[model samples]
Each structure stands twice: as C-alpha cells, then as structure tokens.
Target: MTDAGVIDDYVTGLRRVLRGPRGPKIDLVAEARDSLLDAAEALEHGGLDRAGAERAAVEGFGSIGEVAPDYQETLSVPAGRRPAALLFVSVPLTTLLWSLIWRVFPTGPAAHAAWPGWFVPVARGLDILQMLVGVIGGVALLVLGRGLRRIRRPGTG
Candidate 1:
C-alpha cells in the first residue's frame, strides 16, 4: 500500500477502537498521523525510500490492536465513576420516592393501626428496603467519589 493508505488504515483502526466525542477522536487521529509522518521522515533520513520509510514507521509503531488499548485507556473515563454518579443521582431520588409513597399512604401510627394487617407488614418491609438502599447507595457514592477524587488529585495516582 501507499504511504497515505498505510497511515489512513492505522488511523481508521484507531478510530474504530476509541469511544468518545468526535473532537477527541479527530484530535487523536491528527496526532497519530503527525507522529507516523515524523517517524517516516526520520526513517527516510536514515536512507530508506519513501515507501520503505512509511512501512517501517507503521511497523515500529505497532499494529492498531497493540496501541489502541493504551489510547483508549487514556481517553475514556474511568469505569468506576459511572456507578458513583449513578448512586449519587439515585439515592436522593429513591428517598424522594419513598417520601411520596408515605405521603400518599399516610404511614403514621394511627394510619398503621387502622390499616389492614397485610398493609402494615408490606409498608414496613418497603421502608426497610428503602432505608437499606439509601444507606448502601450513600456509602457507595462516598467511597467511589472519594476514590475517584484521590485518583484525580495532583501529584497522586
């Protein structure tokens, strides 16, 4: 293949592996193209012809499968944050839902006493479940968000 064809294929393979906004992807492609051309120019200076220089550049850079994962890791958001953000959003929403349910059903002492036996048990069960969810979600949000923050902090991994 021609020099341009080889570079195009490399960029195309990279684009296939990367997952993000178009702006980042385009930037990555441009950077990769520039790097490949630079490497090719270096090889040409070392006495290889244009086609040989391009081929050597691509080979030295490694195949798309080999290099794309490193780029993907750098470009993509860390997976842990997704669950943390979800928990942050969900905890309050769940609490609000339970609050709305209680408001609609009136789950106070008098209401509980007047309600059917099955109703009290079911309501109590739901309350327990809601509390558990809220506690677990809150803890997860704290832990995950804290961990992410630490990872992002300056001079730290």
Candidate 2:
C-alpha cells in the first residue's frame, strides 16, 4: 500500500535533523522507515485506512526532536573512529613510502654530491626530525586508540 503524507513528513524530518557518517545515517533512517511502514501496514490490516494508519504510525514512532538526537549520537561513533583508523594506518605507510622514494629516486645535485659543511648537518638533522616525529605520532595513535574506548557519550559527567 502507498504511504500517507504523515509518514513522509516524519521521515523527512528525521532525515533533516540527523548529522554524522552518511552511511550509518542512511541505514538508520531506512530502518526507521521500514519499521514505521510495517506498523502502518499492520494498522491497515486491522481496518484503518492508509492516512489513519500512517498517522498512528508516526505518533507511535515518536517526534523528530526526541528521536534524531539518538541517531546523531550513534553516528558520532563511526565518525570518531574513521580519523583514528586513518592515522593508525597512514603514518607508518607514509614514513615507509617517503623512505623508499628517497632511496629509489634522488632529486637534482643533492643525490650525487656531498653537501657543503653546514648543509650536511642540517640535512641530517631534518631527516632525524622526520623520523622522530613519525615515531612520536605512532605512539600517540596507540595511546589515543586505547583511550577512545573510554570516551564518555555526548553529554554526561
């Protein structure tokens, strides 16, 4: 059976208010729609017309203000995870790739000739700094990854 305007309006409001990872947001709204449709179908089978069943379904589902926050909160989890996961995988890969590139292909005169006095030490220092930063970043990622599990929800003491 076709949905009534009330169901459409409710779903639209739900979609409008939610914010987070797109995939999970879509899945949550789709699930909510399916549930409401199911409820409306049952109500229709019990003899209510389409409009009446849909109105009842929307009322039973709850208001957008009440429901949307929970959905947005759920979305925040995967949103938070993605950047952490990216950093965990990326930092090492970046360090290794840069090292390989430096070894395989040298740029200009720098590769063939020894650097003059101050330049040599400065270059070596920069290389050391790069490596040090990568190591520190990796350690930080590990600590943060573990700490992410202990994070409090949106609002609480």
Candidate 3:
C-alpha cells in the first residue's frame, strides 16, 4: 500500500465519508488528503520504509465514527425532541385539517354526502389508527426528551 495510488484511494474513500451527512464537521476531506500526503513525504524524508509509513498513516487517521463527536458541536444539533415534536404535531394536524376543509367546503352537498357514504368509515378508521400511532410516538418522544433533559441537568452526575 506504499504506492501513491493506494494512498490516494484510501484518502478518497475517507474524503467521501467525511463529506457525508453524519461525518465530522471539521474539514476532514482536505485534512485526510493533506495528512496522507504529508505522511508519505515524511516517510520518504526519514528514509523509512514506505509500506510501514502508509500503514501508520491509515491507522493514525482513526475510524470515521470515532471522529464524528469531535465536530458535533459545530453542527449545533438541538439536544431534544424538537424535530420529533414538530413532526408529531404536524402530521395529525395536517390530516385532520385536510379532512375538515374537504367536508366544510365540498364542491357540492351531494358530493359531500356521497363522500361520507363511501369514505367516512375509511377515514374514521384511519383517524383511529393515526391517533394510536401519534399517541405512542408522542409519548416515546416525551419520555426521551425528559431523559435527555435530566441527563443534561447540572449536578446530576
């Protein structure tokens, strides 16, 4: 793996992963490339074997997962269920809203009566299922949010 081509391949892979959504916020793509190249140059300058230095360089870069948290703060991810709450609130509300709008502003009364005859039972069933899912998911998120808050509380440790 002392070959420049081998080193470049490793660097390219690292770059792609580092640029991915879950990757480190630090400029890891450039950093990995530069670090590998520097390692190669250092190996040559010190008269050390290329193969050993290449191995060392790869090892020193560390696993990508291990590198994520180091830069997580830069991403400013919120510490709770803000996203979850937003989703839970929006979904059922949107469904119910659309249902009401369709009922109240039907193009015609005959259409409205026909709609309930054909679709009310189905819609009611869906509403029940939606309620069950929303309750379960919301409760889970609430519990998780509370746990996170407790863990972050001062003097809790």
Name the best candidate (by TM-score).
2
Candidate 3 similarity to native, TM-score? 0.39
Best by lDDT: 2
Clashing pairs in 2: none
Candidate 2 ranges beyond 4 A from true positions: 94-157
lDDT of 2 at 125: 66
Query: Is 2 or 3 the stronger prediction by TM-score?
Result: 2
What RMSD does model 1 have? 7.1
Which scores greater on TM-score, model 1 or model 2?
2
Estimate, for each residue in 13-53, the C-alpha lDDT of model 2 and write its tens digit: 78877767889989998999999999999999999998999
Q: What ranges in model 3 sit over 4 Å off?
A: 1-34, 63-96, 102-115, 125-129, 132-157
Clashing pairs in 3: none
Candidate 3 Cα RMSD after full superposition onto the native fold (Å): 8.6
**Candidate 1: clashing pairs of residues:** none
Worst 10 residues of 2 by lDDT: 148-157
Please tell me which model should have the higher TM-score, number 1 or number 3.
Answer: 1
Give a tens-digit lDDT track for model 3, residues 1-157. 3356656767565444432233443455566667877876687678767766776666676654554334333232332345566666867785886688577647676677556464676666667767776786776676555543433321122
